[model samples]
Each structure stands twice: as structure tokens, then as C-alpha cells.
Target chain A: MSTEQQTIDPLTPVLSADWGEKRSWTRAVYETGGGYDALRRALRDMTPEQVLTEVKESGLRGRGGAGFPTGMKWGFIPQENPNPKYLVVNADESEPGTCKDTPLMMASPHLLVEGVILAAYAINAHHAFIYVRGEILHVVRRLQQAVAEAYEAGYLGADILGSGYDLEIVVHAGAGAYICGEETALLDSLEGRRGQPRLRPPFPAVAGLYASPTVINNVESIASVPGIVRHGAEWFASMGTEKSKGYVLYSLSGHVREPGQFEAPLGITLRELIDMAGGIREGHELKFWTPGGSSTPILTAEHLDVPLDYEAVGAAGSMLGTRALQVFDETTSVVRAVLRWTEFYKHESCGKCTPCREGTWWLVQTLKRLEAGQGEEGDIEKLVDLCDNILGRSFCALGDGATSPITSAIQHFREEFEAGMHTPAWELFPYRASTVFAPEVTPA
Target chain B: MTQQSTGTPPISAEVRAELVEIGARYPQARSGLLPMLHLVQSVQGRVTAEGIEACAEVLGLSTAEVSGVATFYTMYKRRPVGDYHVGVCTNTLCAVMGGDEIFERLKDHLDVGNDETTEHVDGLKDITLEHVECNAACDYAPVVMVNWEFMDHQTPESAVQLVDDLRQGNEVRSTRGPRICTFRQAERVLAGFPDGLADEGPSAGIPSLNGLQLAQLNGWGPPPGRAGSDADRAEAVADQGRAAAQATAEDGQEGAVATEASPAGTKHEDAPGTGGEAK
Candidate 1:
């Protein structure tokens, strides 16, 4: 095991450094490990502009799939805006393969709390909100407890650390909605409205969170700030490739010996991560994997060594979205996998726009037929046609993302989908006969 | 709030106070809508019409608007739910890892299908089962969530037994944290109240801490040749320098503190008291 570990490169642990410690979530443990030291440095030493400059120099891109520059995002807030500004942390991590944020908050909420303070200070916001998913009550409790500790310890509240900067942090819980992960949709949900994407001429930076200039950042992005501020910008910039700087929390789940969040520098390949994860479950060979989340196009074993950075992944015909690396072995059926992802998109399509709402529904019907081996001739072409219509025509990325697996599976595994067309899914993989489509079987 | 025949009465004084408190946290009262819906679900087992009406009254919105928001979110059930809501995550990853089998097993064991409720199964009453989308705990694939708390790495046999335990009224606890509470108790916690059990046990599991442990055991620090040879040393020096500057800044701002001091407790004034420890 140790020999296999040495095969993978030794990567730095940034956001995940303190995650393993006992009681890492507590304020005492966090502070003892230099938790809020960065916030103190930013508040006492650097001006807001300097802090902004440091982040920009760090070249840290958003970890929430978009890959937008984090510093540039903070800089988008108009400094001279008369209305009060807000900073909203997007903790509603609902992407199919994404699981980093929940664990981060559950294990170390103070890291995020300290980062929120620094981010609010850098962006000159008085109020910050962490909109977490409501289903994870334990995480919400941990965050609320961490916030309460921050207040009692003077990390939050008026005159934080006696720096004369007053900032309030609210830990808000989001009821279940995948669409809310989208920034504009998240803002709408935060404002107590349906979680649907809004028109984006005036983005969230200009008009968000009750018509205030709000900077909505992903939890990983914000949590990365404290380390950047604590260590110099050059320190962060030193890691990763030239363009995509710093480490990211790469969530590896499914069909792996050790499935969890691996905090590696950007541009590491799936081959390396898989090695670190003790390779695929014993005896199974890698068949296919999602480079990011299910939203990103699926990559086969052929693309194992492809660098997982935004530009590289884009060049490879997928986005580096949320770093949700879901691995599947040869035993897994591609058609069944695509069908499950499509069903998720169908269920979560928010019904906001014509293309996503209507397109996802139709796509699911076709995929369901394909998976059940009832697909007629021309079903594959029909699937592609549906994807083409929804890709760019949808109101939001949800529609486009819903098409990723369908289109990508056909690209890589057309034979699997075709095999299912004639033979029932259970027949193709007899092992799943008792489970996959068993619910639809009527009782005698 | 208008009275209704939805079985639940108009919002109680305690619920009204909680709603008002949640509303104050947001700049716009209506922004408190989701938490208010959670509050309603906490008391009514689901978002009843009466609960929606009370939320509308508190947020100064119409019942139609409140209902729309409540219906939009999957967590806000429109009808009464079972005491335990067993949500099997049949997302792509979990489904491939026996989630489908587990879902089928639970349906058979509880005699319920997706989003359907069964009455008086064994000793359990109103056990609602749903094939939930990804619950975001895919690391523990084949995951089942009861009352929104994780039951990680479940097999068909284990999942069936889980429902049986609940049906038999056994003290079923989550893989993490204290003993699993009822669905309503979980709802109240989701509604922004802490159950005070969050501190009882380890919040994370072995899977969660796997990466950090591996990194340490392998002697893997930051990526090489960047961020200085020693990331810890650089951060320590920076911390000490900043700590010195902070001390000087605090000493200099002694008089300014008086002028800049906003009212105490104003920061979290709008935060909910559901957990009672938030304050």
C-alpha cells in the first residue's frame, strides 16, 4: 500500500488539512491550528484593496464548476454602490457527484466562517449568508454552532478582533432543490422564491440578495481564501498549473477502494487520483468516469491521463465542474448509468424554461426506453436530436448539463445503449436482474 | 392568519415568534420563506395548508405565493408523512452500487413504493418511502437517509433491517452523531434549531477523513516547488507577523472602539432560536 502511494505525486492539503483532526469542527481546535489567523491578518494589516489584489494575484478560480476567477468575482462588486452589499456562500451542493462542501462544513465549519469574514472584508460587505442544503441537518447544526462560537469569540459581530469592521454572518438552510446550485437561482431561493434561474444581464454581483450588490461564491472557493490570505498570494499561485492555481478538494466516489475527498493541486490526472484511492475496487478495471460531476461529459479509460484543469478538460470536451470524480468499473453498465443521471435531471428540472423543462422530460422518456431495452430503431439519433435542442436553447445550464451524459455516453458507449435496445437491461447484466427494474414488476 | 379546516390550526404563538425571528434575519421578510416552511413542516409533519397560510401571513405574502414556494421544494411535503421518511439515494453512483436493490428491498419490506406511504407495517405507522435524488453523500454510496440523517454504505439486508428496526420502534441511530430522532425532530433541526446532540459524537466518518489521513501517512504536504519548501513554516511566520500587527492595531483602536461599537447582539439578532444555542 505504501509503495502504491509513492507512485502518486505528493500533493498539498489546503482546504482538507484540518479535516482529519479529532474535534476539528470546534473553535478551539480550529484556532489552535491557525484557523482565523488569516482573517486577523487581513483585518489588521491589509486594506480591502490589498486583499483583493492578493486574491487576484493568487489566480484561484471558482471551484463550483464555473471556473470563474475568484478574485475577479470579488472585484465585480461596485465599491461605490450606495446600497448595502452582501456576500452569499453557495453551500447548496446538489450536483450528482458533488459531496465536498457538506463534509467540509460538517468537519470544519470554522474554516468557512473565517473565510466568510475575510471574503466579506475584502468585498466590503456588512452581511454574509451561508445558504446550506436543509436536508443535512447535522451540517446545519454544526455551522450554526460554529457561527455562534465565532460571535462569542469575537470573530464575528461588531468590531471583529477590534479591527472596527462590523460584519454579520447568517447560516441559512436551503430546502431541497438542485437548481438552487446555480447562482441566480440560489439568489432567488435565498429571497424566499422558487429556486429558478433569473436573467443574467445584471448578474448576482450587480443585483442580488434583495437587490444588493452580492458576491455569490461557492463554499470551496470562499474556504480557500483564508489559506490564500494566511500564506502569501505567491504561495497559492505557486501550486497548480500557471493558469489554474492552488489545490482543490477532488471528491472521488463509487467503484474505488477508498472513495472520499482528495485535496490535490489542480491539473492532477484521474490516473494519479485513482492510484491514491487504492485504484478501482479490487479486480475491477476502470471503464468510464465523470471528469467533474454528472453534468460534465463522461470520459472513458482512454482519457485516464488527461490533466483535470478547466482549460484541459474543456479542450477534452468537458468542464472541470466541482471536481466530482465519480469512477465506474467495467462491471457497471453505461446505459444504466446514463439512465440514472438522466432521471435525476428530469426530476430536478425546476420546470422554469421550455427547453430544460420540456427537453429534460422527453430525454428521460427516451433514455428510460433505451435502458429498458424497448428502444426502437432511430432511438439513438432521437436522443442526440433531443440533446442538440436542449444544449443551447435551455434557459439555464441545467438543461445543457442534463444533456451531458446522454450525448457523451452515445459518443463513448454507443454499443451499450444499442445492446439495451433489443435485450432488457436485466438480461444484458443478469446480476442486476433482481434490482434494477424489479420495482416495475407487478405483483401477481 | 385566516382559520382553515386543514386539521392544523392557525400558526401558534411560539411558531409565530419563530417565524418573526427568522424573518428578521433577512433584509426582506419574505426571504425567510424557506425556513418558515421548514418550521411549518416541523410542527405539522408536512407543510399543511394552515402552515402555508401562517407563513403567508407572517411574510406578508399571499397564500398562493407561499404554496408555490412550498411545492417547489421537495423537502416541503404537501401531505402528512410517515414518522420516518426513508429516502434511498438512487443517483447514478449509488444506484449502480446496490441503491436500486436497497430501494426495491425497502419497498417490499415496508410495502411502500417511491413517495408512497404505508400504514401500520409491523409496529411502524405511516412509513413514507421515496427514491430521493443524490443526497450529496456519495462517498458512502448506496446511501439511505432516514429523516435526512445519513445511513451510509447500506446493503439490501441492512436497509431492510433498518426499516424493521424503525417499525419495531427501536432506537435507531445514524452512522454519525447521536441516536436518530424522529422525522419531526429532524425537521425542527432543519428549521434552524439545534437538537443539542450535534456535539455528542464524531460528525465525520472514516470515508470523510480518509484523504487527510492518507496525505499525512504518505508525508504529502503541498505540491512540490510551490508555496515555499515548507508550507507550515511560511504560514507560521506570516501568522506571527500578522499577530504582532494585530496587537498594534488593537492598541491604536482603543478609543475608536467606543465610537464604532454597534449595539451588542445586533449581529445575530435576526438569527433563529430553534436550536436555542444559536444565541
Candidate 2:
């Protein structure tokens, strides 16, 4: 893995370092590779406060959608609260474009296991839960095994290596609900209720699980902690831009030559990552891509040079949400993509808030009309108006997300929408040509 | 057990014990309702009315509540599922990359619509075909999941062939995991029971490491992290802190293992290293 010393290597495979190793998820392979050393150092040497300080200093943002700073979130737990604290790792990664956490937990389950232990210790929580999505049975199996292995290894459970801290990790699986990815809905689902969002401000740190102080974090965010603790805060902060520190898994999929999880310093541009991925497949020009996952507004080829860090992406008018960059070429229809996403949001909406539930269904209907070339002249304006009503009006981000692709696609590809109105989307951009399975057709 | 059951429960004694065990694993008890529902499905295909009663009884909740929870999630089906449940990714990226085509082909071949199960033919295991949303496996776009095991990089032809193989009861394996198990058996694993298949297949797949493969091919590595003495400073501070703790407390090695070095542990210049433990 050594590179020329003169070059700042574009790829930094920290979380993914051992992903390719034989039997990487096993305790035998994991311990041999220093898997629990961070736990050793935390429990043996530093105080819990000190461990918390190192993380706060690292400036690690939540790898989940919102990008909230992890340490600050940990700090929010009221230490003096009488109720027992909890740490829940949100493993329900069902975002349309997000796949980083799945691969992370699949290949290196121990990383998340160790992170759970360390994070529990940092918050003084004796009990932690990993609420994984139930759809991926293998991931649940891998996690269950890893947790058992950690228990056997004494990295988890009471008094690890003679340290006087006790913790227990539970692997809970959620029934299929994308809304559970939303933190409060996750909390609700974890509580064995219908997964739905709750009103905020008693923010989880103040009162969560069973109405106690709690710390909920993403799988990647917690997994990154071992790296920060092993290598100093500066080591983590050294990688990315000032605001968005440390390395992240940039998932490059769709229309790319080699789509996969690219772990790099946060500020790396999509242009460079795409170049590293061997550029768009067969040199088809990049038409539009999601800077983050499907939730964040889509970016075009014009924004390829924008750094993928949170601040830069926000400055470029999109959040660095889960870093799920789904690329597409000109042969793809912007309208069709937006409609598929819209249908997804509608299907998965939890029906919690009125705007999201009703608005998404209506949006799907209107987009279907538009895509089928049966739209009225003012339908484009109506679509934007629907997006405006749905944005920020729902209980959670699902409604807001349903609006992103619609509003953004309209902004960038209005001509495509307008010109293609007399023609169906299948005629405007042949679905066959858009997909790789079909034979290649040269761009106009 | 105060009047938890209204009538004789229809599930087996062992299944009831598993349901109770799932409930006992949670601190709140009700939190185990989801997994209990899964266990119920594993035993009796779909969330049966009696299954809801059992879960409600186990968690001390009303059957109405349990039914509400079951109906809310997509996985908890009202209808009985086939022995094998095949899901094709039909979200945007996967759809654009031919998931739509694959799904259409499967529907035609299986003679079933979305979320519908094929009829048993001469004792063949029923196959339920559903077009699933983005399963977060878009890197291998147009991915399919048989009993929730990833079948990556699938084309329409391959998807049809896969369903056919499943119907024929041929031994099929996950693209990244073990031999394909029945949907009910898979649900047992989802209910937090190990199928002893953890070590069956490769932990990671090709698409999971495309960038790493290219980086290794190009001899690229991470930049020198935390330049100018972070390595030394952090260690010195840690050593100082350890010494201070050692001075106050009697240090006892409760569980000690022989220390040896592993290749994955060795730190490389200008790059992050994997964990090194006392093996």
C-alpha cells in the first residue's frame, strides 16, 4: 500500500484497509491486525473524558446525511442524568444511493463492534444496540457474529482486560422501512413501534430510548472513531478540509467505469475521483450526479470540480449527504430519474406528515403525466410549486428529499422537460441507451 | 402470564420459547417485537394473525398494536411468502442500469406480479418475486437479492435464470455470501439467530474494493497524516497518562495474550495502518 512519497495519494483506505483480507470479519483475523487496540488504549490509559476530547478535537462529522459533528453530539448527553444512557448505531442504511455502511459492516464488522464498545464507554453507557436493517440478512449475520466474537474477546462485556467498565452490545434488526433511517423513526422502531419520526428538541442526547439520555450515531461515524483514537486527532483532522475533517467513503456508482467505495480525504473533487474511477464509462460526458445520496440536490458536470467536503458541497448548493455520488450520462433522462426517486419517496414515506405523504403521491402522479408527455403547459410550474410545498413542511427529510430531485432537475434541465413534453421520455432518451445492458449508441 | 393469551396458541413450543427469548433480550421488552415478528414469520410464513397474538402476548402489548406495527413495515407480509423470496433492485440507479428490465423479465418468467408468489408446481418450492427499492447495492447496479442475499451485477437474462434455478431447487449461492437458503431460514437469521453461515463466503466483493484495487495497481497511498509530531506527541501524552494511572491504581493483567506482530498491523509511510493486537 506504499505510494511515492512526493505524491499525496488520492485514495486513503483506512476503514476499508482489511476489507480484502481472507476471513477479514473473523475474530482471529481481526485481533491479529490490532482491531481492539483503540479499546485497549481507551480503557487502559485515557479517561473517558480524554477519549471524548480526542474525538471532539478530530472534528469528525456524522457520516450520515446531516453531517453533524460527532463529538459535539456525544457531549450533548447529560452526564449527571439519573437515567441510564444508551448508544444506538443506525445501521438501517436504505438511502437510494448510499451503500458505504453496508460494505463497511459486511467486510469489517469488528470495526463497528469495537466502535460500539468504545462509543459506549465514551458516553458511560452500559448497554448499546445496533439497529440494522432487516432486508440484508447477511449483514445482520455478520454483525451478530462480530458482537459475539467481541464478547468472547473481552473487548465487550464487564471489565475488559481488567478495566472496571461494563457494557453489553445488542444487535437489533429493523423490519423493512426506509423511514427508520431517520433518527427519531429509528428510535421509534427500536422501541418496537411503527417506525415514525417524533418531534425534536428533547433531542436524543437529552431524552432518548426509554426516555433516558442517549447517543445515536451512524455506523461509519462510529467506525471512524477507532482510527481517530489510534492515530491522534490531528491525524484524523489532517485529511480533509478545515470544516469536514478526516477520510470518508465516497461511493461512486452508476455510469462510471469502476464504481465502488472510494475512501479518500473529504475535500477530494468528483472530477478527480471520477478520473481515478477511470472516468465515466466509455467517455460518455457526465450529465448530472447526486453530490450526496438521492436526498441531496443533484449536481451537474459543471460542478464536478467542486470539492466533496461538507462545506464545499454546501457552498455548491448541496449537502455532502452520505457521499453517495450516483452518476449519469446525457443518454439518461433527468425527468425519469426524478420520477423514480419521487416514486421511491412516496412508497417509503411512512405517511407521518401530510405534505410528504400527500405531496409525494401527487408529485408522482404529475411526474408520470410529464414523463408520458401528457403534461399541461403550466405542469413544470406546478411541479416546482408542489416541491416548494413539500420542502421543509413534513415531519422529516423524506418530504424535503422528494422535492430535491424535482426542483433541481427542473432548474438544470428545463429545456429537456419542455422540449420533451410533446414526446414520451422513452422516445426523448431511449431507456435502452441509458442502461449499460443495451448496445452502445453514439451521443448526438 | 396474566391472561396474555386468549386461546390456545397455534405456534410450536420451541417457537414460543424463541419468541420469549427475543422479548427477554430487550430491556424494554416491547423493543423485541420486530424480531419476534420475524421469528413468527420464520415458523409460519408471513405475519399470521396467531403470530401477531403470540408477539403481543410475549411483549405484553395488544394484538391491535402488534398488527399495526406489522402492517407498517414492508417485510412483514400479510400474505404467506414463498419458500424463496427474490427481490430485484428497482430504484433509480439500479433502474437506469437495467433493474427495470430485469424486474419485467422476472415478472413475465415467473408469471407473477410485484409482491406475488408463484404457485407450487408438483412439489416445487414457491418463489415470490418482488421488485425491491434501492437496496443500497448500487455499486453493483441491477442487483438482486434471493432471501436477502446479494446477487450482484445481474442482467435480465441472469435474473430469469436465477429464479428458474431457485424454482428447480438447484443449489444457488450468493454473489458475495453463502449458499442460498429459503426465505424462512433467512428470516431466522434476521431474528438474531446464526445460520452458521457467517464464514461461508467472501466477506467483501469486487465492487466493494474497486478504488482500492486501482490504488494498489497505481501504487497510491494516503498522504502523510497529521504531520509534525502527532505520532510522537499523542504517544507521549498517552504514556504520561498511563504512568499517572499506574501510580494510583494496582494494575492487574486479568486477560493477557502473547504479543506477536501481524502483517496487517505494520504501519506504512504516509498512510493509515490496520489494527495491531496482542495475539
Candidate 3:
């Protein structure tokens, strides 16, 4: 058998524990591995306020698309309120190229479960919910089983470990709407309304589920808690950059030698990650990649050395969303791929707001034309115009996320799109376009 | 051709009493129409022709009255969709991603198209296909909604696999919402089963570059008899571009993408030159 060589780094694959062990979902196995030992330490020694302060000092940010400060968001919840407060974990990893959350939830669910309980304790919330996307039922089942084990072992449910802090965890599934992936929209969905985004300011922390204080966070963000509690704040902070601290799961996918999740420091570059993943697939040159999910802009080979962090990627006009590195090879058509993505946003537009609803539709139309080699001179500009409408105007980040790929594709590979316009896609791929656009040629 | 009456009309004593109590919960009587329609559908299994008429009468409207609202959204059905409603998005986004291939696959599987339903199994039809606009999961384009439960990142292969799994009574993995393992018709399905055809006037035209080009040069709204003059076609394209730009401008971002690119949505010269990234 032919084996590929992979380079090693500090941020790459240190957590090589057996993923297929039996009863891996159990609290006992978790405790044996120094899990929820964090919870014991957190609940026994640290005050709830201290937990918040330590987490803030650690400088942990939300792992979901929006990199909001996790500690600050937790701090936003009213401490004095008597109403029911909640900790809802956004496990809806629907963004294209975002494969980090599911792996974490699948392989190490206890991490997230422990994080949720610890978080609920920190915020003094009696109840917590994990709003997982509906698709991954296995992960859902695993989480449900994990929570059951936690409750049975006194890690969750009333009077955990005799601390008198009662915490109940509910794992809820969302109807497949990307808008629900948005924090506020996820809250609206959890409340059983059509999943449209509500106006923020009364964020989930202030007025969430049933208008009670809520701390909505990503699964990865919550999962990091147990590690932070066990390792201490400074230990966690010492690993990464000065501003963007701690280790993150870098999910390397597509056209890579070893496409898998790598836990690394924040400022690691794509070149480093690729080296860890055994570099790009042999014989194929890397063309472009998404820094996070498809919702963030695509970066080309020129950016392979760009540091993978919140601030550096932000400086480059792309987000470090979920750290989902989807590397594509040279054979991939940027225009064709972007056209496919734009079509997705158009179809998924909730139609609640005008900019996203209509703008997405127009974007699909233009992108479809461009992909088919029918794009006129103004098509690229039209796409930019349409993306402009969607970026800031739409009710939620769903709209903004939809435009990321389109603008980025145009930014990096404008000529590929222009070439398509001059020659029909049929001529480029001949038999390929003929079969694809067969129905378009048929009479109604 | 006539305006239908508004408000709940006189119904049978039993149905009227039930609807009145249900209607009382909402501040606006019209909001009750959904739940009331649910009531009608449950009582009749499917929203029957008579049941629709009764709902209109109970709501104090004509048959066309309930039909209009029933067909406007995708939730209510005028005719019986298959036990499972397969609403495939054949719009531009999914279309470019080979959404039409799903239509062919479904037609082959169910032996039906948008206008037809397949042979029934276990008191329900195998499948039916309807083209819908964006289903809101663009990340997974070429999406399919099986009974309002989204199945994202779909391909012709995936669609075929899904149909087979549904046929074999295998548990389908639902992406969001309740995980209904079996094929059961939704209580409230929108009218025109596949397309909202029962509505007045025409539906949104499928815009294409070839059609747009022809419309720009020879003048036409869409196709065949719908063709307009070249000037009219150009005007319409311009208007669509302007409307898009105006909407963009209103959103506070510079409408630079639309305006700067084409200015008036004029077809740029099909020159072999690189396009600029709009952002």
C-alpha cells in the first residue's frame, strides 16, 4: 500500500485518543479521562462570577461564524433576573466547508456536555439546550445518550455533585433552515415560530427563549469550557496568539492528503495546516480555499501562508469562520462553483426581508448565466451589486453569508468568469454542457 | 372573475360553532384561517372541494376566497399531493446545480411530473414533483424538501437514494424540524399542488440569458407569444436592473455592483476580458 507523508506541528492532532471506544458517551469514561473533573473544580473552588472572570481573562471567543467574545456574551446575561435563563449551543453547522462541529460532537460529545453544564452553572441558568441541526441524527442520539449518562451519574439534572446547583440539559433539533443557524433566528425557532430573525439588542443574553436571559453559543465554544476549567486560564492562553488565544479545531477538507480535524493554536497558517494534513493531494496544485465555511470569502493559492486567526483573516477581508479549510485543486472552476453556491442562497432565502429575498434570487440568475457561459460584460458587477444589497441589509447573517463566496470568487478569479462569457460553456466542456443544459434547449 | 366575499359566512351549526371558538383566540380572524383549515383538513383527511367551500362559508367568503389564500402559500393544499410532498427547488440556484436532473429522476421514480402524481401505495401515492423557489439552505444547494422536512446538499444520486429509502420504509435523516420517518401528507398543503397555478395572472417567469438576450435584441417578455419589441425588452431588463439597484441603494450599501457594472443593466459587450470582484 502506498503511504503519504504528513508533517507534524504543535497544533496538529495531539488528541489521538481512541474515538471508537465503547460507552464513550458515558460520564464515567469521561471522568476517567479527566473530564467533568473540570466541572468539579469549577463548582467546588471557583465562584460562578470567578468562572466568568477567568473565562473572560482567557479571551475565548465563540467558535460559531460570528467570533463574538464568549465571556463577554455570557457576562451580558442579567445576574439579577429571576426568570428562567438558558445556555443554547448552536450545533447547526450548515455552512459549506464547516465540518468542525459535527466531528467534535461525534467523537467527543462529553466535552460539549460538560461545557454546557459548567456554562449553565457559571450563568446560574437552571436549564440549557443544544439546538443541533436536524440532519445529523447519530450525533443527536449520541448527545442524548451522553446527557442521560450525565444525569444518571449526578453530573446533570437536580443537585449536581451535591452542589445544590440544579441544571437540566435539553437537546433540541431544528428544522433545516440556515436562518435558524443564526443566533437570534435559532432562538425564534426554539420558541416554535417560523425561523425568521428578530431584531437584536434584545439579544438572546438579554431577552431569549420566552424572553428570559439566554447565552447562545456554538458547540465548539461550549466544548472548550471543560478544557479551560481543567487546564487553568493561563495554560489555555499560553498556546495561541496574544489576542486570539487557545487551541482551535482546524478542519482540513477537500483535495488534501489527510482531510481531518487538527487542534492547533490560533495563528497557524494554511501552509502549516496543509503540511499537517500531508499537504495538497499529490499531483494536484492548490487553487483556492475557504478560510472558514463557504459563508466566508474564498482565498487563492497566494494566501496559503496567511495566518489563520480572527484578526489576521479579518485584516485580509475574510472571516476565520469555524476554521473549515476547504481546499480546491486547479481543475475546479471558480465561476461554476460560485454559481452553485449562489443558487443555494437564492433557494434558501426566507423571503422575510426584501434585500436577501430578492437579492439572492437575482444573484442566482446572474451566477447561473455566468456559469453557463452566457454572462455579459456587466454580470460580475451585477453580482457585486446584488451582494451589496445582501451584505448589510438582510435581516440576518444568512444573507451576508450568502454573498461571501460570490464576492470572493470575483475578487480572485474574474478572468475565468470572463472566459466563460466569450465561449459558451458547451464549447469549453462540449459533451459536459450538452448533457447539463439539455432541458434548457428543449421547447416548453 | 368576481370579488369573493370577505369574513366568515354562515356555516352548518356544528362547524360554525367549532370555527367561531377557534377564531376567537386570534385578534385577527384571518390568522385563524390556518388552524381552521387544519381543522377542515383533519375532518376530511384531505381538503376536499366541499370542505374548502365550507371553510370559505364559515369564514364568510366564497370558494375562490379560501382557494386564493390556500394557494398563495405552500402550506395549504387545494388538491391531494402524494402522501409525501416532494417540493424540489428548480429555481436558478438549484437549477444551475442540476436541479432539473431531480425532476427527471422523480418522474422516473414516481412516473409523474409537476402536474401528475404517481400510483398510490398504502393509501398514499409514491411521489410527485413541484418546482419551488429557494428553500433557504443555500450552503447545500440542489436541496429537496420531503414533506416540508429539508434534505440538503442533494444530488440526482442523493435524490434517488432518498426515494429508494423512502420506498423501503428506511428512516430518512431529516436535516431540521420533526423527524417524520414515514410518508404522510401534510394536513395543510398549498393549492395548485405542484405550482401555484390557481392564482390570478401569471407566475414569475423563468429568466434565462438566452431569453434575456433575445428579449433584449428582438423584444420579448419571455418566450413564444410573450415576445415584445427589442426596445420593450431592453426597457424591461433595464427596469429589472434599476429595481435591483434601487433596492440595493435603499439598504445603505453603495449599489455599486449593479450600477457601476451595467449602469442601466445594459448587456455589456461580450468581450474576453477579466471581470473584477465586486466586493
* Top-scoring candidate (DockQ): 2
Estimate, for each residue in A149-190, the C-alpha lDDT of model 3 and write its tens digit: 788889887888989899877666553566667888777666
How many backbone collisions does model 3 have?
A: 29
Compute the interface RMSD for candidate 1: 11.7
* lDDT (tens digit, per residue) of candidate 2 on A107-145: 889989988888888999999999999988888999999
Cα displacement (angstroms), candidate 2, residue B97, comes to 0.2
Docking class of 1: acceptable
* Model 1: per-residue Cα lDDT over A235-309, one tens digit each: 677668768888888889988889988888789999988988888776667898998899999998888888988
| Deviation from native of the Cα of residue B239 in model 3, angstroms | 70
Which segments of candidate 2 are over 4 A away from where they belong?
A1-7, A441-444, B1-9, B223-279
Query: Each candidate's DockQ score against the native complex?
Result: 0.26, 0.33, 0.02
CAPRI class of candidate 2 = acceptable
Off-target runs (Cα >4 Å) in candidate 3 are A1-9, A12-18, A425-444, B1-118, B121-279
Please write out the lDDT profile of model 3 over residues B254-278, one tens digit for every residue.
Answer: 2321232212333322222122111
* Predicted candidate 2 versus true structure: per-residue lDDT over B1-279, tens digit per residue: 211111223587778898889888878889998998888878777889889988888788899999999999999988888888999999999999999999999999989999999977875778988989889898989799998999999998898888888888898889878899877788888888888888766657777877666555554545544322222222222244334334534432210100110122333343233332221
Ranking by lDDT: 2, 1, 3
